[model samples]
Target: MNTSRLEAFSDGVFAVAITLLVLQFVVPDVQSGKLLAALLGQWPQLVTYTASFLTVGVIWVNHHTIFKGLRAVDRTIQFINLILLMFVVLVPYPTQLLGRYLNSGFNASVAAAFYGVS
Candidate 1:
């Protein structure tokens, strides 16, 4: 197959992964007066969402850049690209975990590390 086919597939995966990131933002249950505070308190989720969104965007751009000059792709290249996409697809899961546990004292480190590894 052509490189364009691989790029297209990767693009779709990136789109889905980034789209899933936003699902982490839950509507807060709070009284009228405290709504703002509740929203503000979700800073961790917001931070993770922003970071993950930007990271995925950058990765997608870079992926395109790397493929721009390639004349053809071999089995090894296709396999490597699949591995990269595997990690890319896992981004949302770690992002959600990080957002959910980032503020937890000891758990924060682990969550951050998990996000970093992904």
Candidate 2:
């Protein structure tokens, strides 16, 4: 019922989610001459990764602030927190999708919408 346990669990989930965001970035394979171009081609991935990372960071901060004002968490609060964490963990999937399809013409808009919904 204490906020401590909830905060600790939420922090762990946030840490894991943020860490998983980096897994989407694979090193580009290219010859020395083409390395620059190959790396540049992954702009979408970089953009999505940065955006998701910052969003998670902000969420974590806000979560901490909210918990700080509460003495204890009730059952309803716990369930709502669980739902929020579920969406937090689901972030990487949308981030990956958006990054992969951001420059794919028609799929770009779909991916953006999916990411927004997520």
Candidate 3:
């Protein structure tokens, strides 16, 4: 079943996803802007960073929960795990979308929808 590879792949994906979450909070460029205005502008990034961070953490915890139940794996399970990671890796996109657009009222609705799917 290549158990070692399975575990290694899963761990790698989790690490990358966690890294992506943390990477979202890069210091924004607020050149020559009022301090309060800049803070307000970057608030969306902060909100999304928090939400995506929590989402990755929650899923990583769940990954541990599910893996702990299984004593072994086969090809089918390996592919299934990879598919799940595909979604996990994709999380940063919607998260970035939410972060960039969240200030708009329309963007707020989009954010809720994105959260629902996430």
Candidate 4:
């Protein structure tokens, strides 16, 4: 497979993923006076969004860095790279999970554990 195509595909996925991240921030059906406070109250989700985005950005940079050094990729290498992208695509679920349940306490710890593992 051509490296250019791989990079392009990865870039597309990353762009889509980042754009989709904002969807997790649902707006509540409350009065305008309460809306600002409600949004602000979800500080944990905001933090999760920032952290997850930075992590994804760093991984994308690293992927480009490593791929730039490669002369060619065989079938096995291609599959490995695809597997790497598979994990990349799965990031939003955990991000949303942590964001949605951050106030409950358990999610943050689990998120942190997963964060460390990731």
Counted clashes in each candidate structure: 0, 0, 0, 0
After the best TM-score superposition of candidate 4, give how far the Cα of residue 95 lies from its true spot, in angstroms. Answer: 0.5
lDDT of each candidate versus the true structure: 0.91, 0.96, 0.80, 0.80
The weakest ten consecutive residues by lDDT in model 4 span 109-118
lDDT of each residue in 1-118, candidate 2, tens digit only: 8899999999999999999999998998788799889889999999999999999999999999999999999999999999999999999999999999998999999999999999
- List model 1 lDDT by residue over 1-118, tens digit each: 6789888888999999999999999998888799999998899999999999999999999999999988789999999999998888888999999999988998999999989988
Q: Estimate the overall C-alpha local distance difference test score of candidate 3.
A: 0.80
Better of 2 and 4 by TM-score: 2
By TM-score, the best candidate is 2
Q: Give the per-residue Cα lDDT of candidate 2 at 116.
A: 97
Off by over 4 Å in 4: 114-118
After superposing candidate 1 on the true structure, give the runs of residues whose Cα lies further than 4 Å from its correct spot.
none
Given candidate 4, what's the lDDT at residue 118?
53
The CA lDDT at 98 in model 4 is 81
Between which residue pairs do clashes occur in model 2?
Answer: none
